[model samples]
Target: MKKIRNFCIIAHIDHGKSTLADRLLEFTKTVSQREMQAQLLDNMDLERERGITIKSHAIQMNYVYKGEEYILNLIDTPGHVDFSYEVSRSIAACEGALLLVDASQGTEAQTISNLYLAINHDLVIIPVLNKIDLPGAMPEEIKDEMVDLLGCDRGDIIPASGKEGIGIEDILNAIVERIPAPVGNPDGPLQALIFDSVFNSYRGIEVIFRVKNGSIRKGDKVKFMATGKEYIADEIGTLGLQQIPKQVVECGDVGYLISGIKVAKEVKVGDTFTHIDRPASEAIVGFSEVKPMVFAGIYPVDTSEFEELREAMEKLQLNDAALVWEPETSAALGFGFRCGFLGMLHMEIVQERLEREFDMTVITTVPSVQFRVLTTKEKLLNISAPSEMPEPNFIKYIEEPYINAQIITKSDYIGPILNLCMDKRGILKNQIYLTAERVELQFLIPLAEVVFDFFDKLKTISRGYASLDYELAGYQESDMVKLDVMLNGEAVDALSAIVHRSKSYEWGKKLCEKLRELIPRQMFEIAIQAAIGQKIIARETVKAMRKDVLAKCYGGDISRKRKLLEKQKKGKKRMRQVGSVEIPQEAFMAVLKIN
Candidate 1:
């Protein structure tokens, strides 16, 4: 127990957290030179391609420091704001964290947010300045900021370049020396916290957990406190670069347990595991289930593949507990699953994974935040999709989720960025100057406003110099209405959007214009109109396709040409009266990209 060190790496995206993990793995020789890969901890292909960590990974290492063998358990965490919950869970499982900051970029929005989370978890933070090899490195300034933020001595801050393998030894020593060993009773009843879990078709549910008290063995009967399900531990092991079976995993040790549960839904993140014979009196506290904030309906391109989509989502939910979904039907898109996610990026990653990993073609509706609707009879309901919303007459007022957003950028671009926020209906909360050159602006904005193109617009205005972080601030009342798009005088519910009354006209007009460009022309004229209830706010006309009906009559009489023209005109008018427009899938997707 004295030789065990548990810690994790936390930083903003692209801040060398993954790289430092790789260096640590290399230094400890967890993987030989021939077996090592870049971003070793980021096992997902999407993570490697995007240069971001999407999942939290834990690996145990054997390190020798000053002729003493040390047992090091390192957990690498995602740096994106969407996975902040994952970060919190990872911190809860560790005793300390390596707060890695990019020496060139200094601290970012996510850096501050993650630091606060670690502080809340009561984890000892060891500040490390990374990427010192970059030409624009500012080590002294960053050290000063760390001292101010952490109130730690300047000598405690380790300066290293993760990419260049500088100061790797110093970091390893700091972890063993500064970070305290896990404190728990080995003689007490068994209690372990499930930080994460994954489903295996052959082995069933494999759970990764940190043993808090006593020990677990292969034959131990483990009970999940939340689910009250007991299963004989078929296997127990620790994670190196791969799973290595172990006879026993004692207190303060991180390891995997195969519980013989076949379904993914049986195991959940943040659940407590205890020995069935000597179960703890109470489950561990501070284990909160992840609640998804963003909602979108995902439908298979082929209706027949609905079952495959369902299976895919079930398998996905095994690893992603933050994801929530249920069967739903759409009048426009047929059967699909209305899924909830943490944020837009998380939603995108799941969609991409389904398409790429599951080999299924899917169509996703425009993302929406859950809305609280009050009916005329005072019935409260939660609306996850626009199609789920009741008619305007059936409801009283609707409340939309809002977020407390923080934007950090240079002072010169403050004007444009603030104007952009205002356009997104942002209400100013507070502003602070982090330094003479950098300003942090805080706002309370509707989650719907930021879910679309607000982040891209902020980047555009700030020339890619700004960073953003936000947290849910609960629901707020607004003059919001559902703006529906009508094609050939029929409402397309999939194209419907919720907009503020003040900007409904602009959004409707813009949506109409974008749809007109995306939707192909048909045999008959197509009228594309945007409506708020019965009132049409904007409209665009897609002219009918013209055919040379008279071209077939070469050198014909004037009467013949006139008759042909009249007949063609009459046919077009009839077609316009009875023909229903077929909206292409591209048009549905195009509306989502409309800003």
Candidate 2:
């Protein structure tokens, strides 16, 4: 047990975490040269194309030091804030973390946040400065920053470049020397924690777990603690370039278990597995529960495929435990599931995965943040969608979710960043200068404000230098109203949004104009109106497509032309009464595009 070291890599996005991971694998000879490639851990195509890691990948490495062989279990994690839940789960399973910081960029918001997560789990943190090969690398300055942040000695910080393969030996030595080994008794009853799982069409659900106590062997009777279901362990294996099956996986090791469990819903991430005959006293306590920041509806393009969509979602949940969903029906969009996502990016990835992996074509509604409502009857309700909001007359007050946002950027952009935050109803909470060149500004802003275009705008204004990390700060009373969009005077529940009363007028105007451009023109005029209850604040008209009625009247009398025009006008009026507008898919997406 003392020979096994479990660790993971944590960093901000684009900070060479994956690149460093690749170098580690190469140095340990875990992956051969012919089989190795860039971002080897990020096997997903979407991850490679976007130049980011979306999932946490686990692999084992064997290394010999001081004439002794040591087992190293490495889990590579995503860097984006949206995938922080993945980082947290990986951190929970490991005993130490490699905190990689970009030398040129220094430590950003996500770096600080992820470091805090690792610290909370009481994991040993090894600070490593990456990208030293870059021309703009500032090893000395970043080292000082690390000293201030981590309060560790200057000599302890390791400067390395993943691209140039520098400090690989130092990092390996640090992991073995600094990080502690897993502590468990092989004689104890079986106790294993399932960190992640994936579905297979041919075999069944493959569960990836770390043995906390005792051991698991092939053909052992395993019971999932949460589900209370029993199954025979068909195969047990450790993860490598490929899953290498083993007859036994003892304590302090991570491996995969396949048991002919075909149902995706049966396997739960973070659940505990024990021997059915000699089970552990209790299940292992898992990581913190996932808190979703954004809520959106996902519906199949074809209504009849609702069941198929549900099954797809079930399988996806097995892969992504952070995704929370419940069945719901919309008056306009029909039946669908209301999904809670970590952020907009998380929602986009889920939608894309549904299409690419499950072959499910889906339409996602406008995203909204959760709201708290109190009615005159003294009943409180939690509202995720605007359609669930009570009538204006019955509501007493509304509270919106707020977040504590931290922005790290160069001093030159502080003015613009502050202005953007203030425009989003953000209140400045604190500001501190980590250095003369870098500043960190803190704000308290409503979560709903950032759900749309705040991040994109911040990136644009800062010229891609600003990094943001935020956490829910709880709820506060706000003058909030439900803004509804109506097409041809009929309310479309899918387009409704909960906005602050002060900004509702401006938001309504922008939404109406956006819908006017996105909704296709039909035989009849489509009046796009944005209203709060019965009061219409903004309206736009999409004119009907008209055919020239007088084109056939060549060299005709004025009376003839007049009669033809009058007949055509009457026919158009009748068509307007009978014709219905077809809301294009882009119209639903226009809500996100509205500035």
Candidate 3:
């Protein structure tokens, strides 16, 4: 099947990879125009809600250009840097990649990184300049940049608007001409890469793969090319979202398989699968392990939802292996899970999916970096969530993870962007002019310091013109402490925090104000204090209610009292109650919220 060509689309955020995938599905008549949904590959509700690809997706299309039916497997990868590991795994599944560069935006860092990964994989690279129909699309300029930077022909630019279905046929033609077809012994040992997988109650785990050689069929005994774990292929099919049972998945074909696999970890991404008859000696380790660079706690507002939260995480983790979670107990939150994720966006996506798909509400702790803590006694503890951090005095040395970032923007906005980066405790590494009007600034910044609201702050300061790219740097020893927040002598788990010594006053004062905004008038005065070590650095007062006496039950309506109590009870679930009134989650969140 060496004559078969396989490829996927790679692009930056908002560069229209999914938009183009939808158009291709329609253009090739794989899915009818009537059913064409914009960003259709974003099948998960979370992806649609967030407007980003959190996981990779593959769809096979049988197109007849002449009299011959050619099978085209289109792999769609996530564009964000957080999912960089995922992008490379998807790249490993195919023989070629379609590099989509925004016509107006030119080549950003990710375009460069992904292009480099594809090149390293030895895949045939076809550069497509997308969004050409929109204004500010400097197609020629972008094309020139691609040739100069990527070493591709100037005429290789397939200018197309995936939204408007322009130059699509040419894209398909390029796939046929430029990308070499899948080739190997179709009769040899079966080797396929598990690029992505999903779980179904009825089917267990459904794994997707690009057949590198030989064929896969139902009832065939297969082993994980990497783990050497064996399972009988109960069924082999194509993923049209659900399994479409097919007779055989020959080499060069992209299909989904069910091995009745119960555990998600065994059939890991980049793990190869082969028949036992001609099992490969070693499993392919084409993909890298996904490690969560950021950690937080996901506590259900109502503790009863803990199991449901775990279930939701299980389902979500099937698609996103990078999202990590485990059972954890907090004095304030009772039973909850400590979740580790790639970044802030990843954390948000998980929460959104849990809320939307599973219909559960969760309170998340402030984002924290995993610190390799060295205690005065030489103990090692990997601390992430603020509440889980060791006592300030016990920590002899603390090392925090940092990232090297590239910020590209207009020349006029460089100063403000640089200023904002420094404000986040960033160390400027270098600055260079990418073009006459644009500049790129490099910085080494602690991941935790910039996790929560940095992107929003960046957009606000740069007028949404700057594009930032970050890759993890080595960890460094830093002085840090967890600042506990107390409201009327009760510790708020959500308000507990990790902070720098010098910014305690500022952070605490700002947190006190934020707590005030979150805490409503109560029956008793609430004293909110932010303290580092043993000293209180900031305080706020929420005076006892003057009028909420509810002086009278008012009506003969007992229902009104019940409704009021029920609503108040629900809100109190997220808040700690003192005497007869309740506090809020913000009181906890405020410990970290700075002015």
**Best candidate (score: lDDT):** 2
lDDT of 1 by residue, 1-595 (tens): 7888999999988899889999999999898999898999888889989988888999999999889999999999999888888898899899999999999887889899999999988899999999999999989988887888789999999999889999999999999999999998999999899998877778887899999889998899989998888899889999999899999998999999987787667787888999988998887664566878788889999999999999889888877777899999988889999999988889889999998889999998988888999999999998888877788999899999899999988899999988988888899899898878878899999998998778778889899889999988999878889999999888988889887899899989998999899888999899999998899999999999999887678795799999988998999999988988877778777766876
Between candidates 2 and 3, the TM-score winner: 2
- Give the TM-score comparing model 3 with the true structure, all chains together: 0.90
Over 4 Å off, model 2: 555-557
Instruction: Report model 1's TM-score to 2 decimal places.
Output: 0.96
Which digits, one per residue and each the tens of the lDDT, describe model 2 over residues 1-595? 9999999999999999999999999999999999999999998778999998999999999988788999999999999999999999999899999999999999999999999999999999999999998999999999999999999999999889999999999999999999999999999999999999988888889999999999999999999999999999999999998999999998999999998888887887888999999999899999888999999999998999999999999999988999999999998989999999999999999999999999999999999999999999999999999999999999999999999999999999999999999999999999999999999999999999999999999999999999999999999999999999988778999999999999999999999888888888887787889999899999999998888988888895999999987987898788877877777778888889888
lDDT of model 1, residue 370: 88
lDDT of each: 0.89, 0.94, 0.80
TM-score of 2: 0.98
TM-score of each: 0.96, 0.98, 0.90
Cα RMSD to the true fold for all candidates: 1.7, 1.2, 6.3
Displacement of residue 558 (Cα, Å) in model 2 is 3.7
